[model samples]
Target: MPIISKQHGNTLLITLVILILFSILGLSLLSISISGMSKNEIREDNIQSQDLSEKGIDRITHQINSELTKKIEENNGLTRTNFINLLNSTVNKYKCTSGGSIADSNGKTGSYNACIKEVNPTFEKNKPTVENELRKSIVFESKGKSGDSTKILLTEIEIGAESAPETLKYAVGTNINDKDGIQDGEGNLYLHGGVSVKGDFKVDGNIITRNFGYAYLNGEQWIQSLLPESIPSDGSTNSKLVLGKDSYRLTTNTGYNNHIDRNTFTGSTYSRTTDMKNLFSGEKVPKIVQRDPVISPIGITDQKANFFLISGEYYSTGVNKIPISNVNKSSSKIIPTYTERTRECVRGFLICFEYKNVDTEKESGSFEMNGTNRFNQFSTIGSLELTNSNSTFTKGLYVGGNLQIGNNNTTYNSNNYSDITLDGPIYVKGNVNIQGANLKSNVLLYVEGEVKIQYSTINGKPLTDGKQGSLIIFSKGQIKISNNSVNQDNPSQIKGFFYSEQDLEIYGVGSNIRIEGGISARRIVLNAIRGRASDKLFTGATKINSNDYFEGEVGQKTRESRLQIIYDQEIIETFSNLKQPEPIIYKVEPPLVKERKI
Candidate 1:
């Protein structure tokens, strides 16, 4: 009976040991399960915090874009500082609530706080401080917080000019109506043969091109056409080529035909246009038109003249021969002979003057030269003619009527003897004719009428140090260059600005025409012809040409004349103060976001 009792006690002890082991195992499993749940909850909270931070960035972007759009719609201009203030205000409006918590539209609860850590505004290089509207970019470094997670987001915005028009910013701009390539079409702008523009190429009408032409705005190629269909807005179409409102198109045909080769474009053909406009505003379109620069006539008086050679009452019955020279002799009051002339014999030359007379109807003044005429100044009321003469003026020449340079007679082959030089400013109220005359000057030639430069070498002095003048030839009427006026010896070396209020025509068989400075005109026509009628296409008028033929060669001769217009930054900058189109901003790179742990 004792042995049986001991065995029962041992069995009871074994059962107690087994129950203790089971209890320990159950507690271990419970602890492990609780730890796993806690880890999952922590991970989920971290993910939500990151998402909140990203949301903060997106929210700020949307707010800023909306505010900018509103400002643009109001036509209110903003400076760099003003833009930054707007950004900061928008960011503060979308900040997290008091408890470091914010709720998204999806009912997801998280905490997010965003503040602009850094503000950077970019301005155009080499521009004046007053042109701060030409700011290139503005960057905002923002920090967002959600619980223990944080993120750093970089937002960049581009800025542009407000008063300038987009179309006028190009090297060539035309406001003429070009319907079916006629009407105001004579003034149409043309680009061809490796032409490069530093700025944009804006045209109110259609564009016509035959060779390759490239336009670079701020060192970037501009390839998109300004057609309505090319624009990003929903209501864009291919109707009117809106000035200051559309992109500049490049094509070989007048209407939208063979556009610039896509391979030549810098970015996607149509993408950059939308991207550029987006940088300005998401809602409202940018301004297009602006005032043009005013050009006034330079004033002159009789006190500035040396001698009044042509009296105001004198009328030309025929070609009058007037001998002008600096030579003066006390012995002879009458004009000396042309053969026995010496520089030491004269103190100064005679100057022609004609006052505004209404009573007497004077015939067009004509002059025939017997000898070399040197003068300090020359002025005329009626049309002044210089046929077969060697003339030189040191100070100025003001012609109230037409100033004919060479003989109009086709049979007149004395062009080699026609050498003219003017050192100072030349103001002509009528047309300027340079026919077969070798003219050279470092002067400002301003013409109120048409300018014809044909079969001559017209060299303008380049701007140099200590020389404060620029070779500016401005014409209120058309400027025609025919039969190789540019010196072939210096080929493509014509420097300075050549501007025309009317159309500019470059026709005739000549060497490669290279205009170095800037060419701004109402319209530009480029044609290659072997006859005179083709030259009249640009002049907008008909005049008797000595070399007229019954049937002339009129075919598109592209190889004979290759036109090149290279943009000169210095020259363009000098004229920046003139009225122009506003600039458009765009983003070059994407936004960058990085996660941070706190």
Candidate 2:
């Protein structure tokens, strides 16, 4: 009985020890599970906090950007002073001390604070501040927070004028309204070859150019509102651009019969307008002040001189008059005789023939020159024609009546080659016709009436000597260029700035032509259709040149126009010479973003 009792006691002791061990193992497992759950909660909080901070940044950025866009739209452009004011207004309205909190329905929350400052800018006190000493930037700071996460963001927006685009720097372009291309076509433009233009053309007409050459077209102010990657909203067919073939490609090899393929028909889709309109609007042409001659020749005042030599120092419209009416024996023309005998009439060899009598009633006594001639300073009241080739005029010519220039001069000695040379300013009141003349000189032709040029080599100085003044033609009436390369000895180039209050026209001959310079006009017409017409095709009033290149025909795809344009800086820089108002320009840079975590 004593032995059985001892075994039972041992079993009871083992059971007590086993129960204590099981309790310890269960307690350890429960502790491990609780620690894992706490770690998961911390990870979830971190993700939510980071997202909230980013959301804070996005909200503030969007709001500020919206305000900037609105201000720009209202003012066309924001000046430096105006921009600072805007930034201050925005900062006051939205900025917060510490931070402003934002909570979402999902229990995610964020806080944001904003501040703005200018970066390294110097401006004159109380002055209009036309120029900026150093490029300025608007820097923005945003402090974003959510839960335990915080992020500081810095954004920089640059301010100042940007370099003008290649298209906007053309020496030639049309100056008209933006919607005119849609509403009226008043600002129509047509060009080919290496074409470039300023930022004012609104033409909807199909422009033509070569496949390889560049077509640079800068649209109007409002047209630039759309992003570069976006197209016009209306999506009209007229807005589409079509470029012509390089006539030089098959120039001699193909004739009217053998033409180019249809694949060469390319379109101009990369037209870029600028924010410059909002920034700067050029002033209109100033009023012209009439300038009178310095001295009047005593004896020749009674009779109206056809071609005269005036002697004296002069201003814009100087008249020291002498009539060499019967100088040339060939035709009944008045050619200005340049001799030491006639050169004595006026000082500085200044000559004026009836300059002040430009009234329409006094349009009689037209002057004509039939042979080659050369003269110094000259001005006339009646119409004058340089009929024969190789005529040279130094200084300038101010005419009151119609002038016919550059008749036929095939052979002439020039470093870059020219049949006619007008080495100075040309001012005329009546229509001026330049026919079949290769002109080589620096010309600033300002005409009150229409100016027509055909088969001419205008401003074709050699590249080395091209520093001469550009060929600037400003006409109150329409300006037309046609059939330039009828005889394709030269390229029939017209370089420099061309402006017309009315329409501008360019016609395609069998050969190619190039125009370099800034051009501004109401509208443009590019007629690439080619055909031949006999002398009997027109009436007696229309003078017929047997070698006329643009008689007109139904334009076929194979036979197209070849044209090009380049260089515009000279136009913008020298437009004041035409008594035009100046333009102010600026540009906006992409924002630079920097971020930091705390």
Cα lDDT of candidate 1 equals: 0.43
Kindly give the stretch of ten consecutive residues in candidate 1 with the minimal lDDT sum.
Answer: 224-233
Which numbered prediction scores highest in TM-score against the true structure?
Answer: 1
lDDT of 1 by residue, 165-246 (tens): 2322344555543333444543344443223233333454434443322222233222211211112222432112224333
lDDT of 2 by residue, 1-598 (tens): 8899999999999998888888887788788778877676666556655555455556655666567657755765554456656655654454444243222334445555555533445343223364343234445555556565556655554433332222233233344434323323353343322122322223223222221211111311110011011011122211112111111121111111111112132234322222222111122111112222111111111112212324332222122232332221222122232233434445564443322222222333555544455545455556777643444445446576787777633332222223565544566778888766667645666677898876555654443434544567767788887646643434555656666766776644333455556555666644332222222333211112442323232322223234444443355333333221112222333333533443
Q: Quantify all predictions' global Cα lDDT against the true fold.
A: 0.43, 0.43
- Model 1 TM-score (2 dp): 0.41
Candidate 1 C-alpha RMSD relative to the actual structure: 16.5
lDDT of 1 at 539: 32
Name model 2 segments beyond 4 Å from true: 1-152, 161-438, 441-451, 462-469, 472-477, 483-485, 497-501, 510-512, 517-522, 529-562, 565-598
TM-score of each: 0.41, 0.40
